[model samples]
Target: MTSPRMIQIASGKGGVGKTWLSVTLAEALAAMHRDVLLFDGDLGLANVDVHLGLVPTLDLGSVIAGRARIEEAITTYEIPSVSGAAGGVKFDVLAGKSGSGVLSALTRTEIAGIARALSRLSERYAHVVIDLAAGLDQSVMALCTPDSTTLVVVTDEPTSLTDAYAFIKLLTLQDAEADIRVIVNFANDREHAWRTHAALTNACKTFLGIAPPLAGFVPRDNLVRDAIRRQTPILFRHPQAKASEAVRKLARDLLVPLPKSTPGPVLRRGA
Candidate 1:
């Protein structure tokens, strides 16, 4: 497998602003003029495109059903410039299949196909961020599993902490080689965020026998809520806001990371 730039955004619980973070990162990258693509691998509750107010022109549904190839389904969105990356970036994305429908766990063949398609996209985009579904599922594991940089977003809440621990435990059971980036959202302050992160790390180290580091945290700000309500990104709404700054840092870290061997070519459903 040839390596390509692969990024996975995930969380232990829903409603932790995971989608918001994913879209924000992608939007920020686009603003910076970096070739970017955000894939919605959260098939069960696809909202990445919805958050952007985009219709499901092409979705993983079509790709899975043989109606379309995954690459052919990618949609290019023009980022309204507030300006982000100085190096230059532009990008597009492919939305995942959204349904109550259960995704039959992909066989090795299906996994290979999905990986191949993603690798091709990576070759084109400087960064590809995938928004994975919340919690433990075969889909989540396959979409966010070790081969890519897996970013798990959390918050300072009992529920969030519990789920974050759960996720680390699950990841440890399955695989530990992933570049696990833990982000604490809605942080009251840096200290608050670090405390939450410390708890998670302690659990991982004490119980899971693994080391997953805190990537960063987005300060709790009204800008995030307001932007979503305004149907604009917070990074756009308040370019200088704390949340925007946090996202910028994350985008930079992701943009130039050591590349992974490109994923294999996607295979069409075989007879």
Candidate 2:
């Protein structure tokens, strides 16, 4: 069996719609008939459950504390059919404990154990999308592996671009061959999106000598805020929304098969 394709959605700062993208992206992949597991890697302030309106009894914290097995902590989410589509989409989620700094305080070895567990869990799914916490922190870095496709979410704001550059630079320093890509969120238009991507790419090419391609861009839409407010995935609530269509296109683009050979996990150091 082909190993699951690991995808890590990351960002330099908060409030860039990283979590929203993660949730909708997972749903989009599921809509495409791929079995996906959306793991909330944001250990400290996890809210994937909140975004999806899920009240999971067991979470990653339970698994980490040995109170529950990793598989037992998974909560399945289903989206019923809308717009005459056939069977609706379904995906699994491994939620994180919110308002508790305990998981964030885990040592490197403990993080490694979680990583190994995720590696084992990957065997049963076609894709595993990890929503990493914002900023350059130990928890975020430890979960990033060289084999995963890292999508750095950025906007046109100056701080967003600067922090994203710092993140890509640091990740490159850690793994020179890291598969880094960019996603421009809240873009005003296609021109604006390309401009944002070029700015970040120019900075990386000039300073880091590497230009990560733009995987895709999500346009700014008021409906997106509405979906989030309702605690429903935009793709299901507003399938025809511009942002939803963009994410669906992204899912189709990423559906291209990866290489046959799989690499062993290479977890990065927190420090």
The C-alpha TM-scores of every prediction are 0.83, 0.91
lDDT of the candidates, in the order given: 0.73, 0.86
Runs in model 1 deviating more than 4 A are: 1-4, 81-89, 98-112, 255-271
Top of the candidates by lDDT: 2
Best by TM-score: 2
Cα lDDT for residue 220, candidate 2: 92
TM-score of 1: 0.83
Report the error of model 2 at residue 28, Å: 0.4
Model 1 per-residue lDDT tens digits across residues 1-271? 2323677888879999999998998888777776778888776778777677677676777788789877789887655544432223346878876554544455646755686778766877767888888987766766654567778899878888788788767776677565676888998987788788888878777887765766678898888888777656677668889999989977765555343442122111220
